[model samples]
Structures are given as structure tokens and as C-alpha cells.
Target: MRVSANLGFLYADQPVTGRIASAARDGFDAVEFHWPYDVPPEQLRAALTAGGIQGVSINTRRGNLDAGDFGLAAVPGREDEARAGIAEAVDYAARAGLSAVHVMAGRAEGEAAGRIFVENLRFACEQAERHGITMLIEPLNLRDVPGYFLTGTDHARRIVAAVGHPTLRIMYDVYHMQIMQGDHVRTLQGLGDLVGHIQIASVPDRTEPDRGEVDIRWLLDQIAYSGLVGAEYHPTRAPGDWLRDFRSSS
Candidate 1:
């Protein structure tokens, strides 16, 4: 499994454009970005090229970090907003030469939201195809995101299945899944072909792999055997030290 770091959280003290550089300097295989539209595509591309790093994924958009707009992919009466978001993401990804974007199920929705959700997904998927990018929809946990409609692996899987398109897939985040649901391994196995990308952070503390309750190495091994790309996170300390545990033990 190739590793990637989410620049959203880590490298907070540095310029957002420096994210890819830091990830490369720290030995990350690739890096992912969250809500990076604010940064110009050419600048981002330049950073990626200079850092000698590849981008794993980038989010379509959000309501800024403070507003907690994880994404409005399934919200009711937001087709235009969703479409605009998709278009922007596709254009950005096309320019950046990125492979995927995380489609989010933002707010908790009522029955009406469900209908709108399907429509929004189909719309987004259709848009994603035009730019050769895959839309990876992520399900946030109720504890962290409380009321996010896409909260479970099964639901995410079902939604992707319903979309039934090549470009739409699930962003299987182990962190949220472990927090919202306990069975990570089972879900990964069950979800199977639908999982387009995977992310991980230890449960309870959202910290480095060794410090958390989940067995990070074991999970990586499982995901590796399954042939999935494992995106990255920042360690509170130097990454070499953190990853040393993995290398020596292996």
C-alpha cells in the first residue's frame, strides 16, 4: 500500500503550499489535500513537482474549516452547488493531474435529502468522468461530524453501488469507520471492489499509529494484501522515528 499524508491537518504551521514539500521531505510516498481550491492549481502543481511527490487525493470543496462544511454532496436542493463544486474539482484535478477527489456527505438529512442525495451523486459522477477523475465519497462519523448522512460503510457502499459508475467510489476512511463502527477489517473485506481509496488514523485520539488503540501495522498489512493505497497523516513527532517501528519490526 502506498502511503499519503493529508495536508489538511498536518503541516498546519506551514504554508498550505508547502504541504507537498513537507510530505516529500518526511518520506511520504504521496500526499493528499483537503479543500485546496483556495490555492492556485499552477502553484500547487509547482509545489508537487518541486517536492518530488505525487498527490493522492484532494477534496472538492468545503464551507471552510470553521464552518464544518465537510461537503454538501447529498444535501437537499443543492444540485447547483454540487455541480459547481464538481466542475471546479474536475478542472483543478485535470490541471494538477490528480487522480481523485473526496465527495462528502455533509449534513444529516431528512427523507427529502435522500432523493436529492442520489441525484447529486449521479450528477457528480457524470461530471467526474469528463475530467478522468474519480469521485471518492467519504462518510464521516456521527461523533466527530454528528448528523453526517453518509455515516456507515454499508451506506457508502450502497450509495456507490447505486451510482454504478466507474468514476464514483468510496473514500474508505478507517478513522471514522472505527469511531462510528467497530468492524474495520470486516468492512474493508466486504466493501471489496467498491473501495477506491483508503485512509487511516488510530481511534480514540486521532494520533500516530503507535500511540493509538488500533494496530496500525496490522491494518497496513491487511490493506497491503488487499492491494489498496493507504493515504497518510502527520505524526506529532518526526516521521522517521514513527515509521522506524514499522521498518524494524518488519
Candidate 2:
């Protein structure tokens, strides 16, 4: 199974560019990013080329942390900001040679928030299609991110159906789903093509997959997903050490 290192969590000790090199050295097939807007696209592209690995995906910018904005897409009265973030993400992903962008749904609720999310996603999909990029929406666990708009697979699926756009799809994260719901294998099999990306981390503690309650290797073997599986875990030690151990065990 091919794996992508999630730069946001793994390799927290290094800079973004350094993390790319570290991921390459650790035998990762690719890398994924979260809020990498601070790094210029050209610089990131060069780093990826030098590391000899591809950048598979990145997240749209989080609006304002101080204001407690986790994202902008699903928030009512923030359509312009959300669309701008979508445009920026699409353009950056194109320039950085990334294939997908995960659009974050901010802290929100009620019917109006849902309506705004769907409309913003439609606009995002339209922009992404022009560049041959896919738009992803992930269901974050409310415990980790309270008030996060998207919090369950079924809800995310409904949103995708509402958007009815080819480029828009779900990012199924094992850790979050395991917290909100169990039966990972069945859920993944059921989602099928609606899933555009997959991410994994240990449940509850959010540690390396090998050290968690879940049988990650078994889970991997049961699934027939042909895409890169993101290792989005918080490492207890050097990430390379964890990867080496995981490789040997697998």
C-alpha cells in the first residue's frame, strides 16, 4: 500500500520543505498539506521536485484563528471570503502540481449554514474543474473541533449529493470516523467512489496507527483503495522511526 505523509502532523520538528525531504527519505510515496498558504507555490513545487515525490493535496486557507474561524466555506455571511479562499486554493494547487484541495467548513449550524456550504462547494467545483483538480470535503469530529460544520459521513454524503458536481467528493478520515462511528471497513466499502481521498491516524489518542486500538495493517489489507493513504498522525518520536517500524511490520 502506498502512503502519503501528512506534513501538517508528521515531521512537526521540521520546516515544510524539510518535511518533504524527510518524507521522501522515509519512503513515503507523496505528501499532503494543510494550510500551506505561507509557502509560495513555486518554492513548494521546487521542493517537491527535489524530494522526488508528488504533492497530492492541500487544504484551503483558514480565515482567522483569533476570531475562532476554522474555515469559511459553510459559514453564513462569509460567501465572498469562502469563494476567494477556494479560488486561491485552486490556483495554488494548480501551480504546485497538486491534484486536489480539501475545502474546510467553518464552525456553523442551522439550515442557512448548510445552504451556504452547498453553494460555495458548487462554486469551488466549477473553479476546480477548469484546472482538472478535485475538490474534497472532510468530516471532522466535533470533539476535536467543536462546532465544526461537517461532522459525519452521512451528512457529508448528503452535501455532496446536494452539490451534484463531479469534482466534489469526500475525504474519509479513519481517525475522525472511528471516533464518531465504528465499522471503518464497511463504511469505506459503502462510500466507494464518493471518496476522493483517505487519511489515517490512531483513534482517541491520535497517535501512530500501529500503536492504536485499531488494526491498521488489517484495515489496509481489507480495503482495495488504489490511492495514496495519508499518514496523518501525531508521532510520539521521530516520524522516521515510526515509519521504519511500520515498514518492517507490514
Candidate 3:
């Protein structure tokens, strides 16, 4: 029932890292960064240490988007390139004392692309073990990330099972799941422990928890009852205000 705030977009509007700590203090138990490599890892580590918070996870391979690389995992025939990116991500997360590395799966596709992604992902997972970091492969929705590969929960579950590694798991985002597929609860139930972490934003809008049609309080209850640690990972108009409504036992 611990709630980890998503600082990816939150930090964009509130650049000062301490402000994020204050938000977490308001109610959240921990915080997450989108891509810590984009910022100085030491600076973020200092902020987290000062604020008494935990940086749950962040993206390990978001390509220089403006540079046209969306990510590293799915580029056809680019295993080495993807591995290099993952190495950096692991280094940053390890230095920052993060618990997980959210692997950014690329939007690239096709049979050859799938092969590359699986190979590169397996390598990344092996590398992450040295850092003592669990790798969570995130699946972005096509609507938000058109052409991005790795968009289905069932398929992702299959991949994790096939890989058969405890450290490699899925970063199942509820918002993206609603868009790419339905039955969020069922999907998680199916995945079982293959799911390492979760991110949730309102469906259709990706905003505050209460803003979308999802009854996240109810969802949280389900997750808690199931004995999984579900973070409130999302953006909001007023992060604290949005957090105020969640009852741990609800």
C-alpha cells in the first residue's frame, strides 16, 4: 500500500527537487524519477537523501528523442547500441541508490525488431544484476507513443516468463493499459509476480487520479488485498491535493 509519486512530469513544472520531497512528505511514501540520466544522479541522490524519500525507479534508455532514437531496446539489429545505453542507466541508478531501472522499450517493430528487443533485453537484465537493480520493462501506449513496440500485457508476461529471470519484470502502467487493452485487474492477476512495478494516470487524459474514469482508490484496494506494492505513480494538478484522498485501507 505504499505510494510512490511519479516525478517525471512533476519535476518539469517544479524544478527544485526539494519541492518533490515536500510533496512526498505530504502523503506519498516514496518518489520516482522518469529518467535520472537526464539530470545529474548525485544531485537527485542528494535531494532524496535530504528529503528522506526513495527514488523508486526511472527510465534507463529513453533515446535523445529530439535526436530521433525514442529508446534502445527495440531497434532492429542494434543490440550493442541498446546495451551501451542500459549500462549507463544501471550506473546512474546504482549511484543514485534507486531500487529499479525502468527499461524504455523502443517503438520500432516487425519480426526482426522483436528478436533484437528480446536479445537486448536479456543482456540488459544480466547487466542489471551486477548493480543489484531490478529491471522493469515499460510498455507505452501507441496513442501517446506511436510506433513504439512492446505494447501488450499478455505478450510482455510471456516475454518475462520466457526470459525466466527474477530481476526482469513489467512496469505495468494503468493508463497505457486502458488505452492498449482493458481489464487492468485481470491483466495483473494473470501476470502474477512477473509485474515488478506499476504507474497509473487517469485514462484518456493522463492526469490526476480522480480526473479520469478509473476508480484508483478501488484499484489500490485491490492491489493491497493482493499483497503487491502499488505506487500512485502519476502527474496531477496539485500533487498533494490529489494524494489527500487515498485511504490506505480503502
Candidate 4:
């Protein structure tokens, strides 16, 4: 399976361009970014081309993150802002030659939030499809982001079914699922068809996957055929050693 580096955590000390190159140097086939809006599209494109790696995914802007706004898509009466965010992300992804966009569901919850989420997602999917990109929705564990609207893979699956959009799919994050529900192998087996992308990190500590209670290497091997796995975790003190272990195990 292909491995992608998540620049959001992996290279905290480097510039975005440097991080892209670092990911390629570490043997990652592709890279993902969380809110890479700060970087110009032209700059990102050049970096990816220079690094000889694909830009696989990027996240829709999280509205006012410091003001406690994780996302705007699921929030009531913010449909306009959410759609704008989707449009911006879609345009950016297309310009950067990315394959998917992660639409954050924000902190709102309830029937109103769910309804708005579906509506926003359908709109987002339509926009993404025009650019040959997929729209991804990930479930964040409550312990990590309490009050998050989407907090379970099953719930995300139901939303995808309800929306019934081919380009709309779930981003199954092993780190979050391991904390929310322990039976990952079975869970992934059941939801394999609905998953659009996968991300991994060590459980409890959210560090490199080399050492963890969940045997992350085993998990990656099990789902290797399903899709690309993204290394979305904080770096250990010895980032190079951690990556070496991942390369050796893979």
C-alpha cells in the first residue's frame, strides 16, 4: 500500500515546502495537509512537483479555530460560510492537483446539525467532483475533540448512505477509532467499501505508529489492499528512527 505523510504533525519545525520534501525524502509516496490555505497554491504545486510526491489530500478551512469554531459545515445558519469554505478548498485542491478534501463537521450536534451536514456535504461533493476530487468526512473521537458532530465511523457511514453521493466518502482514522472503539480489524472489515482514505497514529499517545498497544504495523498490513494509509501522528523524538521502523515493517 502507498504511504502518505501528514504535514500537519510530521514536520512541525519545517516550512510547508520543506515538509513536502521531507516527506518524499522519508519514502512517503504522497502527502496530506490540514488547512494548507496559508501556502499559495502555486508554491504548493511547485513543491509537490519538485519533491516528486503526490498531494493526496487537504482539509477545508476550520472557521475561526481560536474562537472555538472547529468547522462551519454542520453549524446552523452558517450554510453560506460553509459553502464558501468548500468552494475555496475545492479550488485550491484542484490547483494543487490534490485527490480529496476533508470536510470538517464542526462542534454542533443534533437533528439540525445533521441535516445541515448532509446538505453541506452534498454541495461539497458536487463541487469536488467537477475537479475530479473526492469529498472526505472523518469521525473525530470525543476524547480528542469533545462535542464534535461526527464522532463515529458508523455514524459517518450512515451520513454517506443518506447523502448517496458517489464522491462523498468516509476517512477512517485508526487513531480515533481505536480510542472510541477497540475492535478496529472488524470495524474496518465491515466499512471497507465506504472508506475513501485511511489515517494512522499510535493509540493513547498519538505518536508514530512504530510502538503502540494496537500493533499499528499489523493494522496497516491488514488494510494495505484497501487503500493508501496516511501517517497522521506527532513525531517521536527521533523522527528518522520512527520512519525507519515504518519503512522496515512495511
Displacement of residue 229 (Cα, Å) in model 3 is: 6.3
How many residue pairs collide in each prediction? 2, 0, 2, 0
lDDT of predicted model 1:
0.74
| lDDT digits (tens) for residues 1-250 of candidate 2 | 7889999998877899999999999889999999788889989999999999989999988899999999999999999999999999999999998999999999999999999999999999999999999999999998989999999999999999999999998999999998888788998888888989988888779998886678888887887788888999988887778778877887
Q: State which candidate has the highest TM-score.
A: 2
Q: TM-score of model 1 relative to the true fold?
A: 0.91
Give the distance in Å from residue 220's predicted Cα in candidate 2 to where it truly belongs: 1.7
Query: Candidate 3 lDDT, tens digit per residue, 1-250?
Result: 6667776655456674865677557777788876656568888888888888777777766766786677878787667778888888888888888888877778687887777777777887898898889988877788878888888987787668767777898888788888888787777777777778877777787776665768766775565233234344445456666666654325
* Candidate 1 residue pairs that clash: 4-232, 5-232
Question: Which should have the higher TM-score, number 2 or number 3?
Answer: 2
Tens-place lDDT per residue, model 4, 102-163, is 99999998999999999999999889889999999999999978899998888998899889
Q: Return the lDDT, model 3, position 26.
A: 74
> Per-candidate TM vs. native?
0.91, 0.97, 0.90, 0.96
Model 4 segments beyond 4 Å from truth? none
For model 3, state the Cα shift of residue 79 in Å.
Answer: 2.4
Give one digit per residue, the lDDT tens place, for model 1 in 1-250: 4567778877777887776777788787777888788789888888988888887678867644586666777776666786788778878887887788777666858767766777777887787788778888887878877778888878877777777788888887778778878777777777777788887777777766665767867776664334334534556776546555655655
Candidate order by TM-score, decreasing, is 2, 4, 1, 3
Candidate 3: which stretches are off by over 4 Å? 224-236
On the 0 to 100 scale, the lDDT of residue 248 in model 4 is 81
Q: How accurate is candidate 4 locally (lDDT)?
A: 0.88
